[model samples]
Target: MVEQIVEVEAEAVAPIVFWSTENQPERAERTKGIIEGFTAETGIPVELVLVDENNIDSIMAANFAAGTLPDVAFFPLDFAAGWYAEGILDASAASSVVEALDATTFSEGSLALVDTPDGPTAVPSDGWGQFIVYRTDLFEELGLEPPTDFESIRTAAEALEEAGFIGIMSGTDPGQVFTQQTFEHFALANGVSLTDADGNVTLNTPEMVEVLDYYSKLMAEVGPKDTATFWDQSRALYFAGDVGMTVWSPFILDEMAGLRDSVLPSCDECADDPAFIAKNSAFVPAFSGPSGSEAQYGQVSYLGITTGANTEAAQTFVEYWLSDGYLDWLGVAAEGKFPMRRGTTENSTEYIDGWGNLEVGVDRRAPLSDFYSEEVLENIIQGANNIDRWGFTEGQGQLVSAIYSELVIPQAIADIIDGFLTPEDAAVQIQEQVEEIQAALATEE
Candidate 1:
């Protein structure tokens, strides 16, 4: 009787590799927790590997070469298009994942950015919308108010500079983050449109030159000496109290918090604490430009599943991540890292209270409600999707690396800002370089 029973052991499920930037440990940790929870609930054991930002591309490439890419992977928006084009990804399968998204709940712009001709490549996870951050307390102390438009921003910059503070912290690095912050704002302020109705490249237009001129003059007046270096360098100067204002996104808030917690304990110990610094800080919205309206924007990154992922599993993960429960957790873990879904953001008293308490202008603050809404979000998504729809074609990455990153941008920035060349000369050089890149890309195509 004791000798009767036989049992079979369950096979172990393979681990899932997750590639994420170093910028988001909180989101990554939360995601890992969620995956673990899913496995516990369903007995679908999956290990999550957190890849460093530097090694992600190479690792993925090696995996592809070896025919062992992760069962599921999260890719940055910039790299997703190339991955999709290389037959390394299967967009058709990804579409099924998109179909399962809670469309109405997501920001329309965010959703739109991820949509592709082949299908939806990724899910919209977070965004970086530009806002002019100034010192509210400083404004009050200087007997000034928050600037309403570009003219006022200029006036404030001048006043701040005279008062012994650099007016703005701007960087001229060719990386998309720095360039977008500087270029898009300037172009949009001057009404320059980057893409036409049919999505063609319009970088060399007169509007773009005007925008660049405005940017050059503005930077000359208030920007840090080495602005052409990198955004992080500029941010470091700002946080160290070397500058009075800057154009920034939610990441700035996180940086400010870290500074308070680590760098200046006295400032942290003050009654107002973060609120005091934040009060010193105010946010300005995008201004109207000449060719286009001033409210110009662009996309930063997107989250999407790997093409070969299990559709059902990917859907469940995306849905869960976008759900109220997960977003609430994210708000706590990552603070302003990810924008909340519409309903949750609207009804949630916490978000309203948090944003309301900030020193941002009332109008600029009001749009925080619509930040995750369908309309504004859609514009961003569409704009990014249009980048590809326009002239950025296959092999454009290499072209971007060589021309924009390695040559034109660096030369232009140095020429215009460092007095090496005049703005007019720099503009002409930039145009010529762009033309060469376009010609080469056209030939390759």
Candidate 2:
């Protein structure tokens, strides 16, 4: 009877459910380590669910309708804004958490992105910087200038293609969110906002049409045979010496350094040492479009505490997640997780400096500085502040989430590539679809 009573009490206790895209793949091992450590020290029970970014939109939607939202969810700020509008997020709790942790430690850009008249919509955690990476060796050999603008990139890609290698590779697969992300990276460079500040549809504008034309023509002419390559595939192809350039996130840098242990370094010069990729590649933190304005895409990750949950336990989890357990958590993808909150309560630059010093994955654990210079790290830090995202500039976050769920932009780009429509017609259809999604979101509000 005594044992039975203990079992009953334990079963009755609520588990702090959490969700994250980081809970899977190569990062999974490191994630498990941190979560286990958090539970061991704090005695807080957690139930973590892993969701891929590609499918998170649908899964989150279903969870939202069923009221099965996790106690804590790792999501991008724009997506979190939609949940806030639906009353599924607690802005008060988020603000309180940020205050308790001392928000000044965070990067200024991240705070600006999350700040709202009502308070922050999400607790800023970290950021992933995206940019175009190319083979410096090839560019030097061919006497090609760096791909700093749309025209220069085109010129370089064509020249590289003539040399029997594709010019560039990126996320072109519609089934993956990377496709939309890749499209947005280029589109944002051209100043394509999916909607205006008044929630007006703006995807069919002349700028958007030009951007799509550039993307489609580039894919059709210079991309890999599968042009549908997502992040991993694109990264792998570039690493394999199959392509001259790629647009990717910082997460791939360690793997490029030969640290991850999953795939052997495939670049031609990497045969003798896996670190060859780190030695030969060039980084471009931002690029310009025909508009003459340069922009870098930033994905700011956040940890949100949901409504109607174990408040104390959730707050404890958030505190631990941001401070004590932060290094272990970010180290899972340490290369990509540029800390949003710069330091712990202990020291101002402690965490940020530690992040930069974390070793890249080579045959042995070696700091990235061993393979590259301070300029590479500086470029990454600079890119973190030049965030370019749609909907944040306008109040159309709900529409952003809706478009993501519907994959509106990806489908339109696919139509144009498949010979079904011209860029102008495709832009019209995309605008109509986005307008419909906007109307539906407004009705829900």
Models 1 onward score TM values of 0.76, 0.87
> For candidate 1, which ten residues in a row score worst on lDDT?
1-10
lDDT of each residue in 136-223, candidate 2, tens digit only: 8889988899998899899999999998888998766766778888888898899887777666778888899899899988987887
- Best candidate (score: lDDT): 2
Per-residue lDDT of model 1, residues 22-132, tens digit only: 334544555656666666655554545666654566777777777766556555555665566555665665565445544544456555544567765666554445556
lDDT of 1 at 12: 78
Among the numbered candidates, top TM-score falls to 2
The superposed Cα distance between candidate 2 and the true structure at residue 323, in angstroms, equals 2.2
